[model samples]
Target: MSELRFVVQLHRARRLHYDFRLEVGGVLVSWAVPKGPTLDPKVRRAAFKVGDHPMEYVAFEGVIPAGTYGGGDVIVWDTGAWVPYKDPDPGAALDAGELHVELFGEKLRGRFVMVRTRRDEWLLLKKRDEHAVAGWEPGEHPLSVLSGRSSDEVKADPEWEWRSELPAERAALRLKAEDERTRKAEDERTRKAEDERTRKAEDERTRKAEHANDTEHANKTDHTNKTEHANKTGHTNEAEHTNKAERSNARARKSADKHATTRERMGEGARASVHERGGADAGAPGPEREHTRADERERAAESAIGGLESLRNEAGLDAIGENGTWEVYGRRLRVTNLGKVLFPGRGDEEAVTKRELLRYTARIAPTVVPYLAGRALNLHRFPNGSHAPGFWQKALPAHAPQWLTRWREPGSGTEYLVADEPAALVWAANYGGLEWHPWTSTVDHPDRPSYALVDLDPGDGTAWEDLLVLARLHRTAFEHLGVEAGAKVTGQRGIQIWVPISRGPGFAETRAWVEGLSRSIGAVVPDLVSWAWEKAERGGRARLDFTQNAVNKTLVAPYSPRPAPGAPVSAPITWDELDDPALRPDAFTIRTIGERLSTHGDLFSPVLHTQQSLPPLT
Candidate 1:
């Protein structure tokens, strides 16, 4: 039989420990070694048997988001092949409560025996062998042999780039967007450089022609003609200037060429590394199922575009009345009751009409779409205007357009209108969708969330400043764990914080972890924050709600237009702004928010791209 591969990982979880895993039956049979490995044969380390992990996890070296199972930073401390000692049938020996294995590793090289003390726990002992020394230190080599990164380094930046496989159509769409952005930036740079070169060339040609004319005049005219001779002297002076300019241009060209060469060399090296890592196939066709599915989605997208085109031709500009026709995502949207005022004019504030609402959604779509796109949207419609009572609508309305994408939560069988395209947002807004709440998870994986969200709701006695204080504490706590969180105004009297994380651990795990985190924060500052679910027991402390972590639960998305007075938006704020004493939750109104976005350009975008895993709290 072939020798089995083994790995000993140093896991800095809720408690610092070592995990010893051996390849058995195609999986890594794992055990938690609390005290870690020792070279002394007399000393025994308590090894608690744990669940089997996939073989691929042997190379994993990153943070597990706080709400995930065994959420913490893990690094491969020792790894190598293991040989069975005496007992050829290691499987039988393991079942009999005694198994001997000789490890050949960088840090660990010796014969070890594991004796079962209980069904779930075992005692790991070093055998008295030639390789055994008087003392062995587990902390001697603390960094990972593969990455050369320490546990602290791994925790600081958990750069986990691998995402769960997305639907081929979605993947292609995302890739196309990224390529378009890069191409646009490159084109702009090239255009400017070309313009500069053309101007310089024209100047050089004009100077050369003038010099030739001056020379011709000097050679043909009499030598005694002072005017022509003077012109020749002037031409000579111009020639010197031209030569200097040419030399300067040559130096500039040489410098530009050198930089270009360096960039090209770097690009070549990057491409080679990508090729080695199997990223060279990024442009190639994916699996047959992905291809077939992608084709179907493409056809659907085409049909949707066709429907929009037909509508555009039908609704001519002349045919529009108070109900104006606006084109969005290539779709002509016929907005009716444009004169209908959603929010009445108050004092200096002008009346906000349905037309303005539609306009706001369209204007903010560029900023809003990045956060709301792919998320299952829960529409809060106010058909009779915001003054009247509005109701939440999770399901797509019966009158919803056929072109809109629908999302059905797996297993739950709950269907929702997905704002996958920009047009959907306009369509919903036109239908009186005043408030847009999107689930933390996306349509691609409804069950797995991208963020672990915490909602801070202050009690009656608590003031807005208290909320700020509590938010800062939470931020510091997360920073201590080496995880960065994003804070945003809820457009109400509260604040919300989100930590972007991987999507493998479901809601249950995340919720439990968040609850524990909330309690810990509450414990630290009992006067400021409370983990109580009920307002009665909250005792006026700010309640940090972790309940929004459920799969179906939704949060008011960033840049979403709230139905508050002045139509304030739920805006993301920098951590530095959190300490501002004058800061208020609804300070960023719809009228002023556009300017903030233009200046900052989506501060919360990193929360979508940065993958941070939650390390088990120390």
Candidate 2:
């Protein structure tokens, strides 16, 4: 005896059934189970044995039409070899009413047992062991070895039949049952419609009765009012009085009618006026509604304005009063009393009088001083001797003393401190000498006063390379222009180049020339360099930063202390030291500059106001 094999083609019929099948004697034994196969061995599920399908039916796939008996796409749900445990033969298993087989399907795998519960019903249960989980969980299925299609497309073939013999007894009983269901459905619909019509009719009748009662009451009141009016008139003669009374009653009624018409006209006029004003009707809101909307908008605007004011205050310009000005360095300003304060340039051209300057300072004091605190700016001071108060002392406590300088301008009788110097230069021979007073004269060569401050980062090899390339490029460009250029080590990896120019060119032009020179250098070394602004791009190559020339930006004054990234000041190193690669950029610091100043006075002090001639750019 050989094991019986079976395969069932399931349409599922819909989404909720299982097409049960078994392979026996090379053909698929089939059944359709509404509840599907159960894992509980004790549960007997009804399974009607369908006629066997051809072996090729295992691959059949297509949609079935709607409203047809057992209509659905066909799918091979399960298939595997099987052998009866009782007799070990195909026919013997049917006779014994029990079967055992190893099953395989899209969602079902491993051994299963089917035992007959009745002549046409059986219980199919999964054998739990190493191949099964603790309980049967939905959607757990092995790959469909039988269907060879996705589980989502699994269906039962519409043509598959469960039995060849027609059960006349069962068909007759089912037909009677369906007829009874149709009758019940029709009765339910009729009853619902009748109930709705009755409800509507009763409501209409009740409303009409209420209207009739209201009309009768109104008529009675009108008659009583007419009688009262007639008695008040007091008619006398019989016939004449009767006529008068009738005429009086008619007049009374006419007057009442006129009054009613007037009231109605007034109401209509009022409604028209409301509509013209865009007011709502009886169901609409009034004028207060519009007021509430406006109020909301006003609050929103106020909130936005408040935020803007707070931002302005943070920028430190909020306190600069209108019509007030201050002398910053040597420039004079005249600020109007408005949001944007203006600096109106030097007053009288010969330098503003101290009295006038002081008055302007006092006017803006309460408003501008708070914002000026802690910000660094240039300041000039008068020497300790001779007449008027020293420039430093006269400026008052509002000015910081650190930036003030004392010096006398050429051809001036009185010695005065001037903070606005074009350049700071130290002759190489003099080294620590201060007597040269290189910047004192206003008539010196224009090229003698300009300087360059290069910020360098030597810790990065690439940054150091970039600095060297820029230094060389700058040297070449200036040499081409016939400008006298001097280079010195910044005491770190960076170098400073000084180009002397006359005083009259102003800081703006001087900065422009520097920017032009930087650009020229950038053009020559595009690969290893770029401008500072361009360097901010992602993965950008390093370049010279030209914006450092903008007005109000002060470079560290020579001999002035600066805190370098992490180290002491390199001070002013000799030109030779700059060529050495070992020098680090972090050698400069504020502490080092202070120490140098105490020991050597200021090396850059003499160069403060030396007049230099600036030739026109060629």
Candidate 3:
């Protein structure tokens, strides 16, 4: 191009930064600079290449709605025209990591060099030519070149709405940092509310006690006055003893009643571990429980009664009832079809029932809920048992209990259930949902992935040893990329390597990074790592999958029960444990997970706590 446009926007976002853009290849190649550019060649400013912006934003200056990515006020700080120096193609030079340009604009003039030091990182330096000043600061020229107004002045104009087509990705670092702030704020609010309640309780108790004391005082005073009358009679001593005892008993009764009222007012939630009415469902306000077609038809009468209360009344009457109430998280779970076998026995071993699955789910809730909470779930339901054909449940049924969280995608009209509490997980188990696959992204940040997954899916002829080798190779790739990754036996054919990333990358960026990393790894070990999308073309090799990085795509959560035999779990493990000759995909089952988790705690805790960012690996 003969001459291209360039502009710099003073962005007053979560942080006050500057956005530098240059017209290249029909888009504005951009970089975010924390500190504005300096004319001194000695001072090299840091710039992060965010991405491209459409040409429509060349003169844009206004506020981006709050809660959106890059939600802030902006001003056209500078406007200019630029031409590449000597080089015919500026795009080719940028790709080569260096670009020399000459500016002929109202404010900026002379040659400047933009050098790429790392992916998404660059250094802008003044070339020490005719326009170079020894100690020039961008702050010296703060007014917008377009509107002749400062950024603050531009922001004050409320009617100027930003309609730029550049949709920025939500910054994950901001969310991660806010985690602490949000927690502290919530804790403070909770503390204050509890304090206020305690103050009220104390005041009520004091008032009641004072009233009782006043009554007791009045009775004692009356008894003293009667002493002189009783003295005239022969039964004076006996009468005095009886009168004092009666007063003491009356005082004791009043105190007991006072305490009972307080306890009643506090309720089960106020007093921790007080899951009252063990046989009665407390979450009646929640959505009605989901049931199979057979269940609905068979228990129309019970369904008419709403939920649980009818079953609770029958709890005392039946010796071996089909439905039973279990107290979980202060809610009475009226689990039905308790004797329904989900996992069949291989030999003399007894088959696993729905009752057993419910128990395990309640047992593992504390360990597994962290991974499931806040994420929209895709449940693998085996309602008729694992042997029967199962289906993946995305849209939550209308009858799903009100307590289970539901998310309706912004535009898609699709509703998804979220596992938020212990009761929620148990409810799913009762609904015959065996396998849990949670979205890679949480509900709060729907399009931003928290972790990048590398699913090692083996072909029909792939062996256990082959998987082991590939697992080691995965470890090498993680180390080479300088990222922290954890291994989990997928509870089936392969092992999954989970790389937790800090908040900043969108699904697109995350997917690109994962795909590039996997492809690079595949190149080194071509025979072992299959790149073919179709299974038939893989020729029995393990396929490295990065496609799971997309939004709504899910991987089985750690400690989740699989729909496979023996009720195996997707168990997280240390890398050293993978080398054990006896290690198999099905080694960790529900029977053994409770003890293992009890001993080791959560081995996958790092995946949630430790986050890293990898360089370009493709």
Residue 211 lDDT (model 3):
78
Per-residue lDDT of candidate 1, residues 506-533 (tens digit): 7656766887888888787788765544
The number of clashing residue pairs in each candidate reads 2, 48, 4
Give each model a TM-score: 0.49, 0.26, 0.50
lDDT of 3 by residue, 472-545 (tens): 77776654544567788988888998777777687657766887877777777787876654466577887888
Q: Which one wins by lDDT: 1 or 3?
A: 3
For residues 1-618, what per-residue lDDT tens digits would candidate 2 score against the true structure? 332334444454556566676656656666667666654444455777667654444333334445565555544444433344435575567667777665433344445677787777776766652234344433354223322344454433221222213342222111134454676567556556443443345345445556776798888968767667666776434557667655634532343335224321111222233345443321122466434534543433332232322232212122233332322222222223232211112233332222322222222222222212222222222221112222211111211122433432121111222333211111100011111111212222212223332333222335765676667566555434434333434543555554544344544355457766666666776665544222223134554543333222223333321122222233443222334565444453422333323322222211221223433445
lDDT for 283 in candidate 2 is 17
Residue 443, candidate 1: how far off, in angstroms? 2.3
Best by lDDT: 3
Model 1 regions lying over 4 Å from their true place: 1-320, 344-347, 530-539
Q: What TM-score would you give candidate 3 relative to the actual structure?
A: 0.50
Q: Once model 1 is optimally superposed onto the true structure by TM-score, how far is the C-alpha of residue 202 displaced, in angstroms?
A: 41
Query: Which residue pairs overlap in candidate 3's backbone?
Result: 172-503, 286-402, 287-401, 287-402
